[model samples]
Target: MITLSESGVIEKIEQCSNLDSIASLEFYSGILAPAMVNAHAHLELSHLGGVVPPQCGFSKFAQCISKSRNLFSEDECHNAMDFYDSKMWDDGICAVGDISNGSGSFETKRASKINYHTFLELFGLKSCDKTRLNKLSVVASELGLSNSLTAHSTYSLNCKDFDDIVQSNVEGILSIHFMESEGERVLYDGFGELHSWYVECGMHIDFDKYDSPVDRVISTIPSSRRVLLIHNTVLLESEINSLKGHFGDNLTFVLCPRSNLNITGEKPNFRLFSESGCRIALGTDSMASNSSLSLIEEMKEIEGVPLATQLKWATECGAEALGVGDQYGRIEIGRRCGLVLLESVDLIEMKLTSLTSCRRII
Candidate 1:
């Protein structure tokens, strides 16, 4: 039995054979594990649940999101954020990399029980402007959120916008959607089925106007800054190798398995990442594209791998990617005691059911 104080410190941990050994327990469950860290999620778009439009390609999905943005009301947005925050807490998410499109969810984050670093997302396809950048900085500072510039995706941003985001010089954590689908890779390489779709949508993208988006982004962004590259389903061997060489300990790949399957019907090459010495993490993404914000579900979807490795992706790797490793990832002395208790069982069953709701005692 272990007790976590109100300040998130571990007060006591006593080994026991039965439930009666612990005194005055408020919550009881099976096995106790360290609290989870969700590496990537867009909380601002929580209001658009169940609104994912059927799209054949990544470009079509982008267009659907663009069109659906206007349909949400301010109150609905607030309610959705609140609902999602509560859900995360109930599911034992101790820390999160929450992407905020605006300042509306600031209060919700401040009041939530979890430790959160909100990334203020910014994107402009054609050109960059200092005025807008300054305004975003001020808003970020006023809200007391971590200021991060995130490019929407490789295929979505122009070079000028990408450069402006990189030059913000407000460095802590950098995030970007990388190769999520084969179509995205093809579009960036200037030979995809979406070429006509881009034209039909009135987006005049001259593939010759810029270099490869992945290469260009990696070169422009500082290698020293800790990066969380999300949705790397189509990332090549060469790109992973380059990242390993340049950003030694500062790079992490965040896999959104549910979202990847939903959009592209494929999963990332976990074997390649495992063998390449690249750290990996997991995320639930936005409810708009995913069915829920449950890391347990994400874990189940990617089961059959070693249990220890999967747990590391959900806990330590996520903390490292979000720049909170020293404080929140592990269950060692001097670290915060953000923990989850699971239903007690034999070691084999415990490993298999640790992430399920039936096993959780947050």
Candidate 2:
């Protein structure tokens, strides 16, 4: 049996015995675990949920977002954020590592019940103004929001701006979009669809000084800071070894399989990550690239991973990656880590089936 205070703080946990049966005790059918965490998301893009089609490939999807992101008015965007924020809460997500390009999601987050760690993402083919990032950080801070300045991706920023962000963010956790698409993998070789697209847009990418994207990342980002690498859809085993060897326990690989499968028609090799024993976490990228922001739904796409390991990815690992472990990852005494009851689980096989669904219990 488990008990909690009025405010939801756990008080005691004891295995129920036949003599302890009490009329007031409640029982629930299905698996009970801590509330899940969404390690990476774009709440600001909730307004473009169905606007971008699925399986369009990364390059075309980027173009679609560039065109459709501003189609809705400010009020409409805010409404979408509010709606999705509630959806995530109802879906039993207790914490999130959200990406924000502007201060658009700040007000919604300030009023949200969910814990949010906003990543102010910076990206540009040319040198980005460092002051702009600081200004955004100031905005987030003024709103009393937890935030950190982060680079958008390895291929999105020029070498100077990317290096500056990496070197200057001496505190707080950092997240980056790593090797998500085939184009990005080949862009380091100076020949890919992404390279051609950059040329077509008349933007210059100064990345030739580095040997490869992995080399640039290793050389630029300090090993001291906690970093979350999002979307290893195209990451190689050797690259994983290099990263694991360098960052050790300070690094986390966050997977958004559903979003990746929707956009690029490919997902990460869960088996490889499992075999490597890396600290893995889960994410639902954005409604713009996914059908829903539900972590349970994201969990359904993960294959070749045991159910227990998957739960850890959805809960404990994600909470640690977002730096909110003390309050929301486990169901220990003194923790009000919201309880989630997962229904329709295959108890016989110890797996989550297609019909599995979750609801908040505490």
Candidate 3:
């Protein structure tokens, strides 16, 4: 049996041999686990939940988000973020690495029960507003939230903007959308639908003499700080090797399979990631590309990974990547990491079935 203090910190853990005389002992039917950490999310876009169509491909999906994001009022967007913040709490997410383009979701996150590390994401084909990004980071800090100025994607940011973000990110985790679509590859090679779309929109992106996306990342981004590479949906074996060789254990590959499926009708090679000996974590990208911000639902999409390994990915790896391991990933003593009881699990096969659901227990 596990015991907790009134403030929710774990106190003691022991096997229950005889519990007839125990005082106020609570028994749960299903497996007990630590609350999960969402290593990547865009809480600022929660208002666009069902507005964007599913399986629309990355280029179309990007266009849809750009077009539909401003359709809602400020109040609607904040309310949606508030509602989803509570939903994620109810779904047993203890910590999150949330992305923000502005201060729209800041107040909600300031009042949230979940631990949030805000990533102020910047992106532009010509130049990005680093001053504005810094101002938002200051806003988050003033509200008593941890934050970092991050890049949106390898393909979105111009050379100067990308280099500025990397150089300015001295502390906290640096998150980037890495190789999530084929369009990203084509863009790097200076041709494809994404490239043509940029031209049609009256913009031409330059890769700044880089050989490949991975080369730009390796040559520019320093290995001194922690980095999270989100959405490796199109990562290749050679790219993985190069990244691991350069960043070593300081890099984490955060997978958002459900969101990938929703947008591109495809997913990363789970077996390849699992066998690559690289650090792996899990995330729910956003409601725009997913049905809900539920890690359980995300876990259901991981087909061949063992439930134990998936749990590690959802909890420990995520917490480590987000630098919140001391408080939110494990059930050890002294940690205030909340407990979650996963119900309807297929214990025999060590798998999470479609019926598996989770609730916060402590």
- For each candidate, give its TM-score against the true structure: 0.88, 0.97, 0.97
Q: What is the per-residue lDDT of model 1 for residues 1-362, given as tens digits with 9 covering 90 to 100? A: 56667776776767767876657857554556788888888888888777875334566666677789668889998899999988887887888898876677788887788788877666545544546645765776776665666666666666667666666564757788878877766676666756667666677554335456566666777787777889888888888998778878888999998887776677887777777788899999888788888787787677456767877888888988888889776777667837775443346644655435622343
The total number of steric clashes, by the backbone 3 Å criterion, in model 1 comes to 4
lDDT of 3 by residue, 22-69 (tens): 789766667799999999999999999998889988889999999999
Q: For model 3, state the Cα shift of residue 242 in Å.
A: 1.0
The TM-score of predicted model 3 comes to: 0.97
Which runs in model 2 stand beyond 4 Å of their true positions?
A: 18-20, 24-26
Q: Which window of ten consecutive residues has the lowest lDDT sum in model 2?
A: 19-28
Q: What is the lDDT of residue 199 in candidate 2?
A: 81
Please give the lDDT score at residue 13 for candidate 2: 89
Q: Give candidate 3 misplaced runs (Cα > 4 Å).
A: 20-26
Question: Each model's C-alpha lDDT?
Answer: 0.74, 0.90, 0.90
Q: Clashing residue pairs, candidate 1? A: 30-342, 30-343, 30-344, 31-342
lDDT for model 2 comes to 0.90
Better-scoring candidate (TM-score), 1 or 2:
2
